[model samples]
Target: MNLTYLPLFYDLSSREQRDALNELMARNPAIQLIDNILEQIQELVRVLFPSETIGEENLKQRVEVYLQNVDLATYGTWVYYPWLEKIVHLLNEEDFIRVRTSRNMYKIDQKEIATLGKKKIGVLGLSVGQSVALTLAMERTCGEIRLADFDHVELSNMNRLRCSITDLGINKAILAARQIAELDPYIKVRCYTDGATEDNLDDLLLVGGKLDLLVEECDGINMKILSRLKAKEFQIPVLMDTNDSGMLDMERFDLEPDRPILHGRLKVLEGLSSIAIAEQLRNLSFPEKIKYLSEMIGIENVSDAMKRSLPEMNKTIVGWPQLASSVMLGGAMITDVARRVLLGQLQSSGRFFVEFADLINDDPDKDFCRS
Candidate 1:
């Protein structure tokens, strides 16, 4: 129904406001009270809307009855704008999310947010990955998102993860799905509550699956080895955000798949067995690797942080940042890459390293060595 918020909020402040509205409706011959009815109905919808619940179409007929008798405001916004803003801030709620615009301020056209009417995104890991999913939901970037992770949100992860303390024991993927739905009912979310493996991975991302940009945020060597190789074989772009020494390393697989260049080192990702990947990581130069990891995480609690139940050789990568540094450079770099990719303006180069402390934003455009 066509309505504006002015009359309803005013109905709250002074008895004079509500009484005036009723008296005016009773006496006025030109302006119908239909607008008031529509406002009340919308308010009811906002109040009664349930979480993980669907609304019936039954109310539309009744709403249409009032709408047809009324005239919508010529301007998208009106005197009620400030009042509604006040209520939202005062009430500190967002269940009834709506955006407003003013007729006079039409000159400024912001870049349109992606209309995620029914699009999808697939996410791996729910550490930083959970935060990424929540941000995407908040922006309404995808109609559906498939969250894949075998881990559970644990007590130690509460500070940086999006889950609540209540969600501490839930499987990450399932918990992430619930979180997304709770954040925005309109979004369709699913989960691969089990580990994303070589066999069931593709099934989890087919038609009834998530087939959008795949986000690789898992922190395990096996998870990453499978993810990258699978994406390469499938000819899909796989993006990885690695937290290293107060920086983020962003890489996209299959950069030039048709004319694939060679980098022998990246063979670390080519169909390696879980044990092989672990051994390869362990064989890295320990002193240098540990130093780099220490710088990234900024702490001396490598053992304490390992409560995350990582690989037997997980210490290889853990030194990369899990506890050596206490910064969030990794998240910032991930955000930058996401922006460029979404804009269809991703750099030609497939990998980038961003150092937050140094503030270096390297162009991911130059030719990389073939090795």
Candidate 2:
């Protein structure tokens, strides 16, 4: 099914555009109309005047004061989503962002919010990346997000992916873009359905403008290496989540251009060109590929469960297992680290862990009431 994720906007104050909206609605009688601009304006007023104590009556008065002489009907813009056959009213971009991120007051202050609004992020996969993208959108961490994935949703992917059954067979990147549009239509999203490869990696990382940061999560070993090579070439920092034991990887290519990829663990392929590396990895057998992957993410550092599961791939299990809980944790960790890196709060680059087992012991006979 062909679908468009971007929403159309109409400014009621403009007679021509308003007439077009009316004409379109008249033609499509089944289109669902949603008008909550007034309530949104009320929320905006509350956010604007945090110090003022406002009840329902005073809130409306505050909205009127902020609107001045502007009519309630034309104060904001109307947005239409083609895929859902629905139309909604929302505040224009500026005020919409202001009220949406109002709760982040002291934590991400006004100055940091503005700074983050101008940053762009590129995500290379959609499984765990889906959660990361959604969290970033909900926090309004960046103004633009780019997604790249060559795979489609599958029934098995539901174990960890945040998608409906109907989304099966849809490209992962496109599905993520639609979800983000529904959440906040103002954020910019670009998709690379062909996935990241040597040919298109440049376009993905440098086309419109160089991305401020890159998040690599694809399954291909070749892509895992190629993407980092390109990121290092452009001096863009990279982040990744291994989806096991809360393992997170951050490579500050931007800060240390000389830093070897994957902390120099794959030093065996150090001198090879990108093409040579791709060809060599492609020729490797299944076991060889796993050997290289182990090098990429320290084999010794992975959980004991993962270590046992690796030998069972295509045997007892079709593939390495991933849990929804671990994926959610990875999303949260990556999003937090991304914000810190972009905002200049975190600088060092290395592997880190936020394992739950460490925080909550699983001993069967441990005292439960110990303080």
Find the candidate with the highest TM-score and give its number: 2
Worst 10 residues of 2 by lDDT: 362-371
- TM-score of each model, paired residue for residue: 0.54, 0.95
Please give, for residues 90-130, the per-residue lDDT of candidate 2 as tens digits. 99999999998998888899999999999999999898888
Off by over 4 Å in 2: 363-371
| Residue 343 lDDT (model 1) | 51
lDDT of 2 at 88: 91
lDDT of each: 0.50, 0.89
lDDT of 1 by residue, 1-371 (tens): 11111222233334566565456546654442223334545444444442323344545654465457554432111112221222111111122233211111222122423333345677788776766677666655556777888777777776566556866667877666655544554466776766676667777556584464667777554456556555555555555555543333333443555423122334333566645754665545645454434443334423443424334345544322252132244444554455455455674534455544334345455324222
